[model samples]
Target chain A: MSLPEDYLRYPLRRRGMDQDRYEWRPRADAPRRAWPNGAKVAACIVAPLEFHMLNPSGKPFKHPGAMQTPYPDLRHYTTRDYGVRVGAFRLLDALKRHRVRITFAVNAVLLTRAAPLIEAITADGHEIAAYGWDTDTLHWGGLVETEEAARVDKVRAAFAAAGLAPRAWLSPARSQSFATPDIVRAAGFDICLDWEMDNTPVAMRTAAGLLHCVPLSNELDDRKLLIDQRQTEEEWRAQILEANALLQSEHDRFGGQTLAFTLTPYVIGQPFRIWALDALLSALATDDAVWTATASELVEACA
Target chain B: MHADPNLYDYWPYRDRPRIAWPGGKKLAFWVAPNIEFYEFDPPANPSRPGWPRPAPDVVGYSQRDWGNRIGHWRLMELLDKYAIRGSISLSTALIDHHPEIIEACVARRWEFFSHGIYNTRYSYGMSEAQERAMIEDSIASVEKATGQRIRGYLAPALTHTERTFDLIAALDFWYTCDLFQDDQPQPLKTKSGKVVSMPYSLEVNDVITYGAMAMSPWRYADVLKRHFDQLLQEGERSGVVMCIPLHAYLVSQAHRIRPFEEALRHIASHADDVWFATAVEIAGFYREHCWDQTIADIDRRGLARPGVGFAP
Candidate 1:
């Protein structure tokens, strides 16, 4: 049997991006800027502090680290919480030893549940950015505008209620609807780190105005390397160092390059894996060419 | 569906028809750059939906879009550096969608073969006429744009009907990148008498490894080198085809591209044994040299079905 008549039709096929969220600039043409200290590369490490609900909605799709077993899934819930409880501090101390300040993308739910943890992160001179409602409430394309807006507002309200203002936004799982950029911008976020389209920063032309985007490295993250890819910690460190070296060379050729990697406590913060993070930081420390900046600093310097 | 389609017989790897590439090179290496376009929203196929998230999967869509905008140029320049002409597995609608990309690839003398009109379209439940029209449209679109006759077919998004092979063969295509049972080009039993299953690989494919397998860039680089080494070693016995199918969306990220470039550099360094040819050239050489012997070998091994003939 044949398909429907309209199946072959190409309605919106055209020159540039199908959506108008951002202008497409090729790598040679993508915007780049010099680092503050004449450094060739800027490393923006994302420290994600999240809360995974026991019973995940998983409406469209389940997040990578979302609960896997049946209800009362304490096994996964506590495993993820271990990031906030024990692992984050271990990595934080290691980061301090390397003398690098990072951006902590705090899920809005964590503002209340881990209030002292958030306070401690701020006290230690790390910047805070807004992650979505929790690890489970992802903003997807099918989500209704009003429903998505309400969720977006929850991030602001949760942090505002805590008398803290975070200017950057990263969607949970980095999933986004067509209107996510517009909504996030209208809600007054200066920077968003969802799109891993490029290593460089870009100012997305949303309906609400310009929202600066700093791409997070989806491939180089700890969950991707150590967990998903099932590579050893040694392999993970090697991959990160290789990525940094690649970017460093590109920086030498071009203007400047950004090497952003995510350090999740549940994944990279495990007692066995923390040394790998230490090794990575120690290696970057020796490289005087690298300027470790917060996500905001990256947006300011590159965007 | 039968247990096996019985398209190609159980032809063993060893002592087959010897395939000698140009310059007596043992390995015919090709870069299959899959230049595809996925629709933001399209009428869903009864077989498979267009996207995972409801309608407009913004992250997935824009990430692919980044390939056309940013990734392609980076990958193209790297290929140019190695003097490797990409045998592009093109989504021909991109000919209309982004002709600048076409012009650039054409300038490098790249070979364009049909992937399909849009990658979003699948060949799962089409009438015989619909599949023909879809295939022909890609041929015409690519022909009109670059003035190159596409000699090969890769099913759009690799979705196919049972009749896909027979249909493509009937339309006078020289090669199909759809099959992966062999590392060297082999014959497909088509009504047209001689249609080659060009040695396009899924394992070495960037989308499969980088996206699906979640491979780290350097790990991917290491795999590429390892894959090439194995093929080069095997090529001495019988000429082997090593195809590295790349998608700009996955392979050409800033951190990723450099390692891929190094892998290419490593592959290209084996100048004597590795003959860098397009899919069409590989097919043409096979037809000229290896087809009759291969058919005879298949018959000698009792692998042939009745009434199969090589178009001599």
Candidate 2:
């Protein structure tokens, strides 16, 4: 069980950014911050408007619910299309009914395909946050910094063409390299929501300037809860209630906290599960302590 | 590389074979406690590196060693309380280094399976002869220590060479926890004898859920509950396998251990609906009753070649 000293000199495998990007500050140690209108808790709902390639190379299908049978999986393809066609509207109507504002993390390519949906989202006064160019293109597996910068520029141009100014960025599938935070900051996004390391929003120093890292719940996400974990509707509802209660208690002790609830139309857009979202929103709406805001609003308040 | 289609015949999940476990249970549940011993420094594999940090990785080694010293005992107590027998995935080297830990597991009558000689040692670039020798060592060590022949193989840290499956089958192992393509026990195409791939989950594994996903202990419990709930509902149509893989270092931390206990307790409460069995028991039952029929069903669907084995 002994080894050579040469192994020690091998290149260190770095995955994400080094710790120098942000200082170590516990959530409890941070200064007390309050949400707008003296709200106890700030809640943000993120809806990812994504487009999966019909025939992704290597893997036959894109996701679990995608068709598993033959090539040209029309079943899964159209099922994804159902998000823009029907699910997005259902979510929009629910948000309207509950009087909650949401942020649609839209892929730049989705704007070309579903411009009307983008218009509808804007008309309803919801925020548009840039997700990526598309689901197929990613920044993780050896994607160089130059190419990533180009992709970011393209995404910004797409948002501008759509008459929207997106100040936030959430990578597709939360995939990024060590240079992602710097690249994201250089691309002019004021906030990045991919990092889930902390419960409270922390500031990171990128090459360009300061970038706010808004934390999202990796466990309570709709895709993980409903599809990957196969949680029943009852369990999904319970998780929301339980998470809200815990965050409220944390607020009572430390200070105000943010709860970012992520929903994807393809997963939570089903007729049966849509009610859970409705129920969660309705419950949150009844609570006077909950301040449902978009990601930008929360980041602005913290800034 | 993508898996060879011939290795596992395509069986669309919708209307496939109906597998019934003992007592009409919908799902067969098992817990695999990977009691391992990681060396402070080990020979390097040409394919992959050993540690993320520098050599003499005291932090990495001691973190895993803490599992044997303290975490394993706490976990074992919880398993005993739930009446769940662990299929101990042993690092064969532990038989020499930590006989006391092996003795405790043996006293509990838990089943033993080979993970590898050492958690630090890997099978990435081993020649066929080297791999065969390692397998033989596993067989001899486990039988000498626990008095039970090894029935399963999970590659050390889930690493494998090209010929891992064929070698395991050639050695007459009944099941493997490597192939994670399906929820049910599916037939694997090997060189010599038949081998069924058990549905051991990387999704629910404590290491992946807590360490990799960065979820809190309570969140980890919530995930386990949700995973079990969905699998139970689906099990009504076809019997499924639910595996909760544990590494004492991750789940048995003082703060994390209670949630792990609570999750197991919640699962154990559904005793009537699920079959609490070892990996060997599930593989044995499937081999005796449902293996042939499952293969036949795959053949009837025209998904695989009849006589040819997997070439990959």
Candidate 3:
């Protein structure tokens, strides 16, 4: 059995990355900048308020924290719904208590559907960034440029409709098509939080212009730690503190470091796990060297 | 289709041939840091797609890129502290994409072997000739880059056709890290020449343990210690091999590195008991010492009888 002649050929094999969306700028070579307060670490906390549809097509691939059961998965539906409903308030309270200005990555459908939730988040004086249309919605490579671009524009338009200007964007599950960066840049956004190539913000070489990529690290993410890994609350806090310690030390030796991570309401907002979030926020506050900033503040300082 | 591959004969892991490593070391240890390069977008094989999501796959692509830009240096420095020269499973195209990494690995005198052109590309539906050309291209790339011939193959993304083993044997590669049958290196039973299946473990592979299994760092560190202790104890009878196949992108994260370091420190403490070696070195030693006896043992055991017979 044989295949096409072009199968083994690598068309995009080049000196730098195979794609042109970004350059292969190593972290070692990147200039390290100080945060606004002369702090060594920029603590960027992102909280995604997503809504998983009851019936998912599960195209391309099933994302983490998606509905696991068959149709009418009320079990998982309510589990995730709890995040936007009851859990988000607990998560917000913790951030508000610490006086930390966090960014809320809201889905497009959630903008119109959950107006009260949107108003609550906005009224709390936190930055609201763009998440995708919904958890099931995807802007993947399988989608054509026009379709993907429309999705980005649709999300941007929804943000405008809500009377809230989105300075940042994070894709649902952080999935993207080849045309995502160009589309995202064309939408007139300042930064995207989907690419996590470094601890510091990077300028993606988008055709629209240079799009600042503020990397929200998935390493110590609350959902990954508490939900996926089945790690104990203590283990989760320890890992967060441990990762922060490492980044702080790296900042001291190198120049700039961002301790950026995502906190899910359904995951970390659970009563048991909420204590861990409280402990982590308190622990991070104790470190005067740590500078907690919103996504826009981070990109402005680093990118 | 044949029920079995027939490439390797079934040889039991009981009392057979006893191997003694160099300097009478009980265990042979090697670390394979897969210095891989996942293309932003590659030609898709009809049987299998490349990225989990669609093309571009900004998240998947950037995560791997982070390894080269950030993780590789961190891992390289840690390995240097332990005086461990990693036998890099390289995506040959990375020789062009990132030469600085290649230069650094060369400076440390690390062993280089072919892991195909790009990790994203697979060897699914290819003419034997085309596959051979791909293999030849990889060999040529490594030779040109490092001024050294590669002696091992772990196919790109571990995707392969049935003819892979024989082709690699014909190409005169010494060993393959693809197989996971035995804890020790064994004759791969190739048609052309001697090719050994080095015990490149999938069990404790960081990609499996960390990525697939979603194991926490604390647990992984403990697993490493226990895995090493057990292998060391087993090696008392005959020599055994313990390979840690790693993806720099996964393990080099700041959160995971400390736990990994603790495990490495535990393994490195047994300097006298372990023969810190590379894949090729282990395969070379196995070929020179254990190849003949192991092949004969397979013959003697009647485990691989030529004539087909039913169990009934």
Candidate 4:
């Protein structure tokens, strides 16, 4: 039997990242702008402080950073929790030594569970950006708009109670639905770090206002580099240096380019891998061309 | 019909039959260079369009055409430099349009496998007779051009009918590279004869890595190195297979080729550990020795069943 013509239409083409809402604007067309203190490159280090629930719902749908295998995967679960227990501290100390203030994309659940750690981060003069309620509760995987809104509200309430009003939102697993931007805007987020489509920041048209998508590097993430790709620590260091060099060359032409180093504490916080982070932070700190700033600071400068 | 749920007999990686290559090597590495012919405007299969944009897509056509005209040579030279023999996944129409490319590959003693008549002409909506004709055409045309009977099948752009595996097996093809489920070679259930599914990666393929993932050439090199490193480690126990699928248009660009060569260099540097064998060689080796035991193990585990139509 011949396959029906409608077979193609059933699994509808994946129309990723609405072009109407976020149109492609060339880097050269971007306005001539300078980062804070006239630095050429804005290096935003996003450290995700997360918690993978002991038991996930096993919803048949999974994304990167989601729990794989089965329930009570203690080896995987404890390894993920290691980010909060030991990795986050190593990262924090490394950043402190380099005098770099990072943006910690905190899961709201960690606000209560690891309150002291969150408090220590804020006290260090770093920015706290929302990274969903928990790692398991994602906005893209069949999450309704109302529930998504509630998740945002819960995150905001936690931040507000701690005298923090996070202006940025980085979704866990970088998952997003059609209503995500509008919902994010309604929830009072100014910048989003989920979209990895471009190198430069692009303005996304939303109902509330223009939401700035501060482009994150999908290639340079620790989870992708270490866990998924299984690169050596030396290769990870080389990737960072090569990426920065390329971006630096591009920045020379375009001017307002941001380099976001996305890090998951669990992945990069290990004793061997943590040194790569130290090397990267130390290298970036010394580079005068790179203006190391939090995600909020970079957003404000671009604004 | 869809793919057979029981197409591949399951045996756990831990307890599977041990596969040994020609040189007692741990991993069987093969590079599949897809030498394709994408027409400027072709007859469409209703299931999918020929191009992303409306046809007479000059830019799209010329870019792929560039692979045949220029990129293929550069890539061939690089592959030759590393003493790597590519298993050319030929879109058979290239034999008519660009016989010189086919001649060049034949001269190098590279293996030829069927990738359909044209890359644009998919097998999505083909009738049983049409699909059979396409397969027969692949066997006839490839044999006529290169004096080599096609031993393997990688469906056009990986589009296949439920009967694809069964058809290939009936036609005496040794292996199919369309299955992406396993790391090791395994027998595919067919009505006629045994056809093993060889490991061909979409993960490490240049088209997916560069075009779909939008990764840089240097990053691609890093990924390839890491992939090879991990597979080599895994191969120390039971043997592993690594297929690096390449498209000339993507990987043979001026800047990209050198980094790609760097990846090949890294892989080649581990010459002692890896057996750089073609898909046919790997399948032949497995069939001669491990085939019966592997199938028996899977049968004992109650995995060797008839089709259930869950085509990959």
For model 1, how does the per-residue alpha-carbon lDDT over A1-303 read when each residue is reduced to its tens digit? 999999999887888788777767778776567997788888899988888765677778988788664333433554566577546766677888898889999999878666656776887789899999987798999999989999999889898998888889999988999889989888889899898777778788988899888878888888987777678678889988898888888885677788888999777765446667888999987788888889888888864
Kindly list the per-residue Cα lDDT of model 3 for residues B135-248, writing each as its tens digit.
899899988888879999888877766677778889999999876545667777666778987877655789877876578898788767877886786678789899999888
Docking class of 4: incorrect
B58 Cα displacement, candidate 2 (Å) = 1.3
Best by DockQ: 2
Name the Cα RMSD for model 2. 13.5
- How do all models score by TM-score? 0.52, 0.57, 0.51, 0.55
Cα-based lDDT at residue A12, candidate 2: 40
Query: Can you write out model 4's per-residue Cα lDDT over A1-303, one digit (the tens) per residue?
Result: 888898766453455433568755666666766886667788888988887764566353454655543222332444465567546766787889899999999888777666667877887889999988777677774777888788888888887887778889988777887788988888899889998666666778888898888888888887898767766567788888777777778766777677887878877775446667878888889988888888777777877
1 versus 3: better TM-score goes to? 1
Consecutive 10-residue window with the lowest summed lDDT within model 3 chain B? B303-312
lDDT of 3 by residue, A1-303 (tens): 999999999988878888776678777687878887678888899999887765666788776778663333333554566576546866777887777878999988878655666776777788899997888788798998988888888888988988978989898889998888888888988689999887788888888888888888887777887656766667878887887788878875677688888889877764335766878898887788888888998888864
Backbone clashes, candidate 3:
1
TM-score of chain B of each: 0.96, 0.96, 0.96, 0.96
lDDT of 1 at B310: 26
The stretch of ten residues in a row with the least summed lDDT in candidate 4 chain B is B1-10
Where does model 1 exceed 4 Å of error? A1-303, B307-312
lDDT by candidate, in order shown: 0.81, 0.79, 0.80, 0.79
Interface RMSD of each: 21.0, 12.2, 21.3, 15.2
Please compute DockQ, using alpha carbons, for every candidate against the native two-chain complex. Answer: 0.01, 0.03, 0.01, 0.03
- By summed lDDT, which 10 consecutive residues of candidate 1 chain B come out lowest? B303-312
What DockQ was computed for model 4?
Answer: 0.03
Q: Please, what are the lDDT tens digits per residue for candidate 2 over residues B1-312?
A: 322224555453445578889999999999999999887878887655677776788888889989989999999999999889999888999999999999998899899999989988878768889988998899999999888999899988776665777898988999998765566888787878778888786657887677655678987887787678767866888898999999999899999998777888888999999999999999999999899888788666424554333363
Tens-place lDDT per residue, model 1, B91-197, is: 99998889999999999999999998899998878888999999989888888888998889998877766677778788788899876556777778776646898
Candidate 4: segments with Cα more than 4 A from true spot: A1-303, B1-4, B300-312
Chain A TM-score from candidate 4: 0.90
